[model samples]
Target: MDLSTLMLLCVFAFTAGLVDAIAGGGGLIQTPAALVLLPQYPVATIIATIKLPSFTGTGLAIGQYIRRVRLHFPTAVLMCITAFGAAFAGSALLTMVSSRFMKPVIFFILAGVAVYTYTKKNFGEHTTKPYSRKKQLWYAFLISLVIGFYDGFIGPGAGSFLILAFIALLGYDFLHASANAKLVNMATNSGSIALFLLKGTILWSVALPMAVCNGLGGIIGARLAIAKGNHFIRLFFLCIVTATLLRLAYDVFVKN
Candidate 1:
């Protein structure tokens, strides 16, 4: 890549990591930017290269979140295990199938999520009524499997979806949900990265520099979220979801 192009990608990577650390739609920024800038590369290679930066960013965010939030270890562990496997399956499927069909479906879902979150003023502000441990585990498994698959397959907004699931299904507050989401997100990213490595699709020269910039952004963003708390996160979530909705709309209606 030329110096100017590399610099532009680094800027986008940092922005993506910052946004993603706070709300989980970093791919909205990073993936599209890479695809647009690095048109010479195969689409799969661009996607795979981006995953390394994503994984590193999520890792940094997790480190910050862990120190501030109380995570449910049992639930998180179950979710991570399921998510990893599901992500691997999903990534494998991506090589065989067109993901165009999923865009409209996800767009609608995100719309509903944005509306519900907006109208329900207290949503995710505090923990909801608790589910039994067994129920929580079951819910976590399902949420992780589905969102992890989506993460690997569709490749955007999976973190936000994970957070939404944890808050809505598992009765977690925003901070707790974000913390758990980071763990599951990390697992999903790792699963996809592993597959890409085996397939020899990633361009490490691009991914490595992006990863450093992304990680720095992740650290700052996570700390900001922790300091700002639920209201800030809720607003950030809405903005990210809105952006994802628009991007998907463009893809489904205009691009296609």
Candidate 2:
């Protein structure tokens, strides 16, 4: 990549990490920008290259969240394990099958999520009554499996979905949900990265510099989210979800 193009990608990566740290739709920014900027590369290569930066960004955000947020370690670990395995499977499947079929379904689901979150008011602001430990573990497993697969396969809004699941299924507030979602997201990214590395698809020239910018953005964004609290995250979440929904709508209805 030329210096100018590389610089542009870094900018997008930074912005993506910032938004993703707060609300989980970084791929909407980073992936599309990479695809647009590097049309010479295969789509798979671009996507795979993006994962390394994403992993680093999420890792940095997790570091920040760990200091301020209380995570449910047992369920979080279960989710991470399940997410890692599911993401690996999903990435393997992606090499064989087209992911185009998933876009419409996810579009509708995100629409519903956006609507529900907007109307519910106070949703994710405070924790609800806790589920039983068994139920929580089951919910976490199922959520990680489904969303992690989606992350590895479809590759957008997975972080948002993770936060949503943590809030709706596990009765976590926005902050705690985001913290745990970062953990699961990191695992999913690692799984996808492992697959991509095996396939030798990553563009390290771009991924390395972008990773630094993204990680720096993650640090700032995570600290901002920690300072601003749940209300800020809820607003950011809604915005990212809406943006993801619109992007999917275009891909499904317009691009095709």
Q: Which digits, one per residue and each the tens of the lDDT, describe model 2 over residues 97-133?
A: 9999999999999999999999999899666656787
- Please, what is the whole-model Cα lDDT of each candidate in the order they appear? 0.90, 0.92
lDDT of 2 at 31: 93
Model 1, residue 121: displacement in angstroms? 0.2
The model with the greatest lDDT is: 2
lDDT of 1 at 175: 78
Tens-digit lDDT track for model 1 on 13-70? 9999999999889999999999999999999999999999999999999999998887
In model 1, the Cα lDDT at residue 123 comes to 93
